[model samples]
Target: MADKVMVDNQAIKKRRSFREWKEDTARRLDIWSRKKPARRKFWLNKTLYLMMIPYLALFFLFTVLPVLMSFFLSFTYFNLLEAPKFIGWSNYLTLLLDDPIFIIAVQNTLIIAIITGPLGYLISFILAWLINELPDKLRAFVTLIFYAPSISGGAITIWSLIFSSDIYGYANAFLIKWGFIREPILWLQTEKYILPIVIIVQLWMSLGVNFLTLIAGLKGVDRSQYEAAAVDGVKNRWQELWYITLPNMRPQLLFSAVLQISSSLGVGAVTTTLAGFPSINYAGHTIVNHLQDYGGQRFEMGYASAIATILFVSAIVLNKLIRKIIGKVGS
Candidate 1:
């Protein structure tokens, strides 16, 4: 009786273990089977996938590869002439701790950003609104005036007038004549004035095109909505404008706002053209200018790549902040 009981206990334990192992094996097989179909389907679309190969290759080549290379380069010291020796964040550390020019550049960039970002958009919005109210015939001419500066602003002649570094340069001559200051202000060379000058120029250059875009947006607004508001005893032009025009032009407003911010951030070419990098006391060095200093002047390809990475990141952060503000206002 004891032996029979022992044999029965052993058989019961064996059966339970077998069942457990079988169930585990079955579950894994089932999972494998399910995954296999997905894999097969993906492979079956080989031709379609092959069609995407070129775009994917280009994406990796241009975008992903550059980003990865920059990230790697940021950890190294490579001047494009020799091997890249890994410095392990020494470059970034030095930038944070000991780089006086970098600190000044950051300060100048922030100042210009604060000045031009909102002011440019606000002025452009006002201009656009005024233009939108005009008759079609006059509107074209006004738009042409506003946009011409932007189109021509990139020219060397325009830059020369603004930043000639000469006593009789256009801005200096005009300011001196007005007795704004006794001496001819070195607009580009002076540390105290370079950033402000750049901001003013940026504002002027951005006014027309952005304003025109806003005007088009305003014109697209539903006239019936305005009429209905007026019929409801809306008080004045200001109220109608506040309620109808701005809300309706949200998309264009957002676009112009972004453009203004981004352009201000990228105000390097003009700076470099007008005031050389390390602008007096390093007051006019923006990230873009910094990148150019490395990429072009020093030929430090790795350092330049790192600077480009930094600029890219800064741009994204700036856009996010601007968008967030716009969202709050729109809401």
Candidate 2:
């Protein structure tokens, strides 16, 4: 504890263990005896800077530029027929105060996100962990089975068959056979059932890139750390995971978190595919759906921009909050 440590966020770093303490002490003690490597000035690293130009240029041109334009346009009313007219928060005002469907959209979006985000995250991690421990051939086969639904172009076709609004639908057939109901229920059409069914489908389709990332993270974890942790009084797998595994996999966890949250919040295409766009009195309406409806269907670009801005801000805030929480993982 003699060495002073400075932190913009102290909770980000867990308390050091005995090995870490010893290593730090040894490094400090041997500092003067070791010859230090020479550091290069900024201009000397021009080659590395040049290597990053393509990616940086593409990111700014596509992502940054679009976001900036959307933010600027959110305050104006443009219907694509004429010049954009500045309304100075009128769109936002209408969104907050005047639009009832917007409120419903927000409510449904939160409901979907709240149910799916953490559930999907946990499910993916657990499944990935199990998969990572399997033998190579079996793992490859199993990985394809789990991952196929996410990448396959015919995913909607598969789901539609299962939940089709007819006597022949798999779910309805199963239920009717068991005498659960007399007739086939309109699983996708009903207001009360549509959102829940969508959530179930979302969870079923949750094993995508996030699942792969966790598997890679689990594989990348240093086995030596686990061995050292066990010798240092780690009692079980749970303890090792809490102290050693998670801390080492922090970067993967952060990346997966962003994907999971984005997937959960941006529930547009799947909702439209499974349930209709504005399904049964706005029961399945989400912010993304609302934005598309206004922007694409109504040609109200300003209102659409405002909706997009709200979503953008919400995602940013949620991401920051999650980053802070995830920073405290090992602590």
Candidate 3:
């Protein structure tokens, strides 16, 4: 009976201790919440905070939350029907070492991005520069012509018709008329021609936002700066372009680079539409297509999320690199 009473007393003391710790923690947290600088600032600018809520909510819902969820999902094994099970790097290992089609997709994606990305930027800038030289009305007309291919949703269909395997196809007819080859070439079907044709179509589509940005940037350049450059013995058009124009257009150039990198890396819709999804031995297959295959067709959301995370990281790295290069344009 004495031992039992002692045990009860100890139990009461232990419970009281726990209760005291809980109260202390709550008090500290309350004090910290009141003293927090961010909380104070938020309340100070209540109207601005209120105004930002909608944008913040949308951004979190669409961009930040999806990315975070995707990153988390990358390490898991998830088929849509089942719960995600943590797999611990197996997906990445398989992607890197075991998957031949993924290897092909990566190679194809890199090839397309390397060739089309810089080339598209150069061509867009050049076209914009030339158009900038024209009278305002003519410049607008020419811009429309170049930009039309990009905005036109059915442009790929037109390209398909032109590159059709039939002898009646425009490209085949032209080639045969010129005696370049006796047979009609299967532009999309043949692996040899697939990448080149896709690149061509991609370049055509590439002139959308970046091209417009270049035009705007060029227009925004002060005419007096060119006059000043001329006075400073900037003897040639090349010098003027290299030293004056490009430096002034850094913001637009940066914007265009980011746009081009993302578009080039994420080139699934066009390739799939033009060449078909798998694309004949995966010749025209890209990382984006691989992601689509896993996510959309196989319902392998985990692997798809891994691919997305990779793409996101690559874009960030490439953007930083391009910014560094662009930073040194004139200097």
Best by TM-score: 2
Residue 323 in model 3: lDDT: 88
Between 1 and 3, whose TM-score is larger? 3
TM-scores, each model vs. reference: 0.73, 0.86, 0.84
Compared with the true structure, all predictions reach lDDT values of 0.78, 0.87, 0.91
Clashing pairs in 1: none
> What is the C-alpha local distance difference test score of candidate 3?
0.91
Root-mean-square deviation of Cα positions for candidate 1 versus the true structure, in angstroms: 14.7
Tens digit per residue, CA lDDT, model 3, 70-188: 89899999998889999989888988889999889989999999999999989998999989999999889999999999777888888888888899889999999999999999888
Off by over 4 Å in 2: 1-40
State the lDDT of candidate 1 residue by residue for 1-331, as single tens digits: 9999999999999999999899988677666656688766665675799999999999999999988988899888888889898988777777678777767777778788788878888888888788877899999899888777766646535865856667768777787788886777667778777777787777777675577788879889999998999999878988887777877887887888777767777778767766775567667788788777877888876667766766678888888887777766633
Flag the better candidate by lDDT, 1 or 3: 3
Best-performing candidate as measured by lDDT: 3
